[model samples]
Target: MTMKFPFQIIDLTHPISPDSPSWDLDCGFTHSNFIDYEDCTSEIKFRVQQIHSPLGIGTHMDAPAHCIPGAASITDLDLHRNYLLTQSVLINVSHQTDENYQITKQDILDFEARYGRLKKNVFVLFYTGWEKHWPNPEKYRNNLVFPSISAHVAQLLLERNIAGIGIDTLSPDTADSGYPVHQLLLQAGKYIIENVANAHSLPPIGAWTLTLPWKIINATESPVQLIGLVR
Candidate 1:
């Protein structure tokens, strides 16, 4: 049977490939043809490829175990409960902030003032306009000085009991910041999605996110395909 849906879907994931940008200085994605079409026999017409990628490469999710000891891994999250379909809020801070800006608690408060107080259990996505630089890894990474969420903002989100947070850049924390935001959120059992693409297309408050991760058991992170379903 064919199925039908009634929402406008927007892809929020970057294409993953060997050339995709990496959070780590030296690591990136790699893949190889494991079974080529040229080598296929009469009985086998399929070709297969093997991919090797850092868990943090491209658009991905960081499970609680990413920063917290003995916490839930990617596979540990229940698809239906944690990620399948979730409410979301977009907080855009592109206009007033620069490349090195740190998103503060006031940024969120301002968003709330404009959009109304955030409802609980919603995924908060930050559209920093950083996505425009995604095609240039040098600029996207920006010498590790890209915009990020301050620890203060992270704590404020935690207080609101959000399901998770997403950003259009490499991470919520700067590379040199020692991951204070990561530790705080992950320890509280919240997941994080980084390198989200096409966030500009989503509305500020009504879009719903559907996150599908490459589930790997006991792994700290997983590459994810995120989609926004909007009316």
Candidate 2:
């Protein structure tokens, strides 16, 4: 039936590494072409000879020409708003003595007073549970504060006109240099989904937030092999 809903596709990716932990505020990830084969001698055809990357590397999504100077990249937006069947909301505020965990405005008004006010286009997912430092570089990018989203909850999800917003870790902007919530959500044209892995495996509410990015045209950010179809 393919319309399940409950929760558990939390994979806010970020394991590309020169030594893992990236972001001095830009460019870092290098996984090279690893051609491997054992045996295939029949009606066989295969070729994926190691594709290296840097469309903003690893578990990505940030188009609107990545901060709106020219705007509308990431394959010129509108792949049905990049796979939206949303209504998934999780706000955990990841803790381990909270290493600079930003995300406030009373955590979006206490999660809309406990799950209510989030409509418009609905697809906000930020569980900040930073996946236990997946590959760790002093717990992801030399931590100071990388659990983000707090320019007043990115202007209160653009005053609830919400059509997009995703995060599990890596770049929601707790400031490393200057991302200002990716320049206030693509300059209010709104759209942002980044590094979302195993948002602690869902179930903070009903689930069905399938984000699918990669139509790579002008490519400012791409590679969103997402899934969260629980029931």
Candidate 3:
């Protein structure tokens, strides 16, 4: 018997199906088939193919080169410096206000107050309860104008110099497309994790972060295996 705590695995990757909505208009996007092998299956050779979204689709990681110039790609990353990060903090900001639906410095401060000084090199994940309405595309993408880190907040992350920053939404910046926040973080070599799922399942603190991006050679970005290991 494998002894473990009551663990919940949140599939950060979006469902890759025909019914699955996608913003393909933004870029050339496609979710291919995801295969699962069952050793004791009765079906023929014991192989099943599951179709899923693309590398950047669903729960995925973003390389620094995404929004910055002359930055490193996913393939050129330092795994020791990136994956299986220590001191993971899940900021459950689900009960956020809607004035601007923006994650201000005050919010971060409040989190710091309760959590006792967010240490450096830890993965900072912002849980906004955004994935709940993923079944509804419009609401998930437009209706829920959830809190996002400001350009100034990006500077703070740089100041903290954390290993990586992640979010449950499609992006860390607002839908404005071209923003200074993304620019600053990318330029300063800040790694971003996006399209996170089921973050609410995580504890407020003490869980481990394991976000993995594919090493597509000379690629700007790739899909990631976003896993969180906790006690």
Q: Top TM-score: which candidate number?
A: 1
lDDT of 3 by residue, 149-180 (tens): 78777777778777777787767777663566
lDDT winner between candidates 1 and 2: 1
> Which 10 consecutive residues of model 3 have the lowest summed lDDT?
19-28
Model 2 CA deviation exceeding 4 Å by range = 1-17, 20-52, 56-59, 62-73, 78-90, 93-115, 131-135, 138-162, 170-192, 196-220, 223-231
lDDT of each: 0.88, 0.68, 0.68
Candidate 2's residue-wise lDDT over 144-164, tens digit each? 466677777788888887777
Q: If scored against the real structure, what TM-score would every candidate get?
A: 0.94, 0.30, 0.80
Q: Every model's Cα RMSD, please?
A: 1.8, 16.7, 4.6
Off by over 4 Å in 3: 1-11, 18-54, 97-100, 143-146
In model 2, which residue pairs have backbone atoms overlapping below 3 Å?
Answer: 10-197, 10-198, 10-199, 11-196, 11-197, 11-198, 12-195, 12-196, 12-197, 33-50
> In candidate 2, where is summed lDDT lowest over 10 consecutive residues?
33-42
lDDT of 2: 0.68
Tens-digit lDDT string for candidate 1 (100-174): 889999999999999988888899999999989888887787788888999999899988988899999999999
lDDT of 1 at 105: 92
TM-score of 1: 0.94
- The alpha-carbon deviation from the true structure for residue 163 of candidate 3, after best TM-score superposition, in angstroms, is 1.3
